[model samples]
Target: MNSHQPDLRAAVRRLGRRHFLTLTAAAAALAFATDLPAARAASVPELDARKIAENPFTLGVASGDPLPESVLLWTRLAPRPLEPDSGLPDKRVVVTWELAHDETFLRIVRGGTATAHPEFDHTLHVEVTGLDPGRPYYYRFRTGTWESPTGRTRTAPAPGTATSRLKLAAVACQAYHHGYFTPYKHLAGEDLDVVFHLGDYLYEYAVDSAGGSRAYTDRVLPAHFNREAMTLADYRLRYALYKSDPDLIAAHAAHPFAVTWDDHETENNYAGDTPENSVPPEEFLLRRAGAYRAYWENQPLRAPQQPKGPDMRLYRRLQFGQLAQFDILDTRQYRSEQAHGDGWQKARPEAEAPSRTITGETQERWLLDGWKDSSATWNVVPQQVTFAQRRDKPTADFKLSMDAWDGYPASRQRILDGAEAAGIKNLMVLDGDAHVGYGFDLKKDFQDPASRTIGTEISTTSVASGRDGADKPANWDDLTQANPHLKYYNGRRGYTVITLGTDRARVDFKTVSGVTKPGGTLTTAASFVTEAGRPGLTPA
Candidate 1:
């Protein structure tokens, strides 16, 4: 065989791949149009808009899990949102969805009908399929002449295909009583591909009728929201209240979001069935079931992600062509109870026990195995807490957050060792729940300044949890002087925008001046970038 002939064959194979991806959407569209009938096969009860007291699409629309050929679209029907039953009679409703290449939807590629059962709180999950690789599409839902706001979503690049750039926003920690969610308004306007909500989607706290620090002078919240979420109905109502925010609704409508939960989703600092308070294991599991059930109903997740009792397999992988692979983990569900009562404590022997695991043993194995043959340029982990060691004092007697990865040093060691064994490159861990933006160089040994750099971790600040924070806390100098691996830090309320490319990944800490009232000006508090091959963070 001629050597030049082999080169020509390689070029032809590349061209063939491009051809397939280009035709995937158009071909699927034609096949769907010819295969299925447009009308619903079975008859259902009709829901007239005039009969219903209010607009059903009050929570707005959202899409998630952007696969190459399909995406999960979500919306709930709630006319009177705060009511336990959402003011709807116990009945099923049919929702029609349309997806098009243009905003006007003149050239719709896919259209379908989905039933919203009262069993699932009238929530709709339309897994629209047959789409081109990395292509943008506009979609909306319709029921009884009521139309939901149009949402824009894009699919990932075709499998094994090389992509140029991917933009993402990491967000978390919203406390309604603390302040308003101003960050989301700015986030909705940004040009981004996806959003990663690491955790703390809603705080299990009480909100007064006036809406906490928001102090809504125009309206009053329902009395039901005045207590922490405990029952399934309470949890569902909490989601409705959070989703009612226009800024948050707009953010979800703008981009697809991939989510994973932390402690606050169920209970503060909860580890599996173990509750933070002195609650019975069996009783606490019941609360967990409620939280998980409500979480699945509200989010744009598929059937497989739904909870079975208190167990939910939320640890899964999402890929963006050959550019990045995100391993979304559930650290709060399958973790060892935090040592030293789950607070900042001196290094303890119990945390170093080999049996101690934060990702659980099964999930740890899965995460390590996924990295073995990863074709993506960046192996990312969108998880709950900080992956790097955050010590209060520089000395050996320093204290670490037991609620974070520092309390699971043995588990952290296993993950780091596994990455090294798998020959993984460009390891990036995205974190939420810190209430402050942080950039750190993940090291094999935090005690040693010359230790090998394992990866880079960026912990994004809260949307409204910490209230209006200062640029530097009182212990800023002490913290900077202590942890040498800590490259950047910002005490504010905002999110992090990550721009990933083949060569490097850059994270811009986007902060707002304040969140107490509303309309805080967004600004970049700091910027950091890590090279593709190298694992340490550097100021960009």
Candidate 2:
């Protein structure tokens, strides 16, 4: 491959052999159409299965950010997915989407034609509205007689109504090459209203261990991903590769996902525009813009979340009638540079500085305002990273992970204080990123173990990143002892199933026995519930 061009084979290899198939010459023609001049691109022929090599719906379908009356639907045309241009011609193609009350489309509620723009990597995001609240809908997309798999999505209950309960799953950190996304298979089987993915959706590490600490897989890494994603095309292709997972696709088709990124989406441990490696400010901003754009294009997010250069407005609020208010946060884009340059370290004055914010000024203010305005039975903060303070060692010394909220002491305190001031009775915090799962009681003050408990936190484990992690970490007992607020901890590959009710919120720490191969058995490793108006977990 030439130094200037991306390695298409490497992009396909990221999906591994199980999910991706080599495309035929006809399909390859579509992908390489980018090599043609702009005038020739306009004259590209229509796609036909007999003329093409593979199915364009290789990436499947997804829905997200569901409102009471509207939902965002997504699909990408990837006949030759591993190809540099997803086997799509260098022009916009028309895609027809249909939403109905039945899976058969017999009762079409909404139907429209949308363009799959080559500018956005041939991905389609159709925002369908005017649907009744709290109703389940089936949607599908098609072009040239080829149809996408039907996806199921539910609109949120009408706001201000007295909703009784909500079922949600919080999942994150699925490194495609690390292992199978078996957890998503289980997540798909669950009855969840919505899914929250707290970042590391796709790791930017190269296929080789030399690029980062990620486990090297047998599959070859693309030259573009051999280091870190730097260009818009690189990030877009990376997202396409990860979206090829059948399990991941099924999960997305099953439920709407509210996503937020932690590190590894662009580069490992990237803090805002400051990359882990010493890339120049302008270069890093360009890379961030690419990453953000690719993320929005691939996911079923709305147009409002589109990236403006390096900046994207991701932190927003979603209401579930009177049952819950989800304050989906973007912790990565706004956070100040990781104090002490990232990783676990002894607490420093700078780490706790009031100005060292993780959510930035605008987003933090938005979150605080959401808390104040919320009138739902449960106020849930769906975010990345642990919310409660965690001491790494068992000793009396103060050592916390600089990568988490523990590093932004003042910011965390403000959130906790805001929750209290808002008279939040059932403040539930949902987060992911520590491949290991954790259950914690949100503390009003972490310095005092006996301080008033402000809420409950359910930190989900990785979808597969840890591979087949042990049932428990080596120092599990010590860590739990060191942090009294932490109720449970498990080192496993899975997600958390949460049931929020008017009287209580129950959480089942669902763990997969393994991820090295497909078909891992999912079992509830632990169950706990926090009663309404009272904080802290009790045996469910």
Candidate 3:
């Protein structure tokens, strides 16, 4: 076992003290109700395991990627409720899945059988193909005598088809300990074509550990995560616990998901070889290897994402027929550490810097060359973190966070320069991370007032996790004012919805009252639009 495990345990113990105090306050509030007949009664409500078995798939079934011919289906078999801690069972069960053109069983199209092994924590990913495009389908899974609830899914129209429009939702940053995922539950109710998960899907922290920035609130998670996850079983159990959330599963079942991971999937502020928590170089690699393996096994990704040790090349292009092409980029795992300097200084070694890289040499060339050659009307770069260069003035003493693309100035400039050189039109950047929403005009130089805008970016805030504690609103507001490029900023939790049409694209920023609460109302706080050939964002 790693020596650092002791340090992590100590941190959790310290955090427990604070949690106990909060619980005491809650107990005091409930103490008044003790006089009621129900409270005075000696018997308490009891839960029976046999009753829960009647609904084996309580977490629900989900499908993603409704393509003209295929869609990915997912489900987990939780056979033993009493053994929730391990989320593993020794017995292997045969899982049967079927897809139909209609909600009823009359038009069955595809069917298959697979085994849910204990090694994968009883979770299964079934990619069903050979279905008609642009048509809705319903699917379900069966294990022994238990049947999962049916889920609906649809595929994208074939390339260059006569489809009029497409609706997609963008979201990210869901830390289970931070808040409830009520926003996802709301998004699942909408009629969407696909969901774009930009990143920060799971946080790698022990449950009792005080969220680095805030105290625990009303959100629920496992009672204890005593150590940093390094083994495959540890990672598997973490994903299982997260996937069990009904809201997340509902959203996944409602529409297809296009996903990418940000720092928290491994560690906060992780650069190429170094993580923010500063695990030794050798140990970091091993942890990364296990983390990547778990990520691939849990996600509904294509075969290309199969993990090989610590590396899983996730940057790839997904075409949505003739309407658009998504070039998902990986900004982590291949960048230099933060530059050392005084104040908000610009990175030195501008043109000849051989050490700085964001997309790496190969991926950068691939992205630029792909942009130059693509024929789609919209060039969408669905990536993690912000791309717009954010800088604090010389006297402000603010520098770029080493974890984001801003740390690699040379490479960022090159990508922008490539777009200019390629004359790529209608370039839209979908960004996450930074826990705040922003719509910026991506300019070659932010310092220069006369700098021309190159493209447009729509940054989504955190789905659940963000700035916690007393300074929340103040910090968010100050960041927004400092960065004039930001169009909207909210300390509250929520997600974004985008609709792409032939001539225009509309983006709606939806915020929930609070994720710390079980359920919250959602409202569109702001909206923006981008015309097909204009390439810049405008108020909707």
**Which candidate tops lDDT?**
1
Q: Backbone clashes in each candidate structure, one number apiece?
A: 0, 2, 6
Q: Ten consecutive residues with minimal summed lDDT in candidate 1?
A: 1-10
Residues 195-303 of candidate 3: C-alpha lDDT, one tens digit per residue: 8889988888765544322243443344545456565556665676567777988887777787788877887767766766655554555566567767876777766
| Residue-level lDDT tens digits of model 1 in 108-195 | 9999998776667889888888788898999999888689999999899888888889999999999887888999999999999999
* Candidate 2: regions farther than 4 A off: 1-53, 208-227
Report the backbone clash tally of model 2. Answer: 2
Candidate 2, pairs of clashing residues? 10-222, 31-87
lDDT of 2 by residue, 29-125 (tens): 2234324224354655444434445678999999999899999999988887766877766655778899999988899989989877566677888
Candidate 1 regions exceeding 4 Å error are 1-50
Show pairs that collide, candidate 3: 65-256, 66-154, 66-155, 66-156, 67-155, 68-133
- TM-scores, all candidates, are 0.91, 0.89, 0.82
Candidate RMSDs in order: 13.4, 8.0, 12.1
Compared to the true structure, candidate 2 yields what TM-score? 0.89
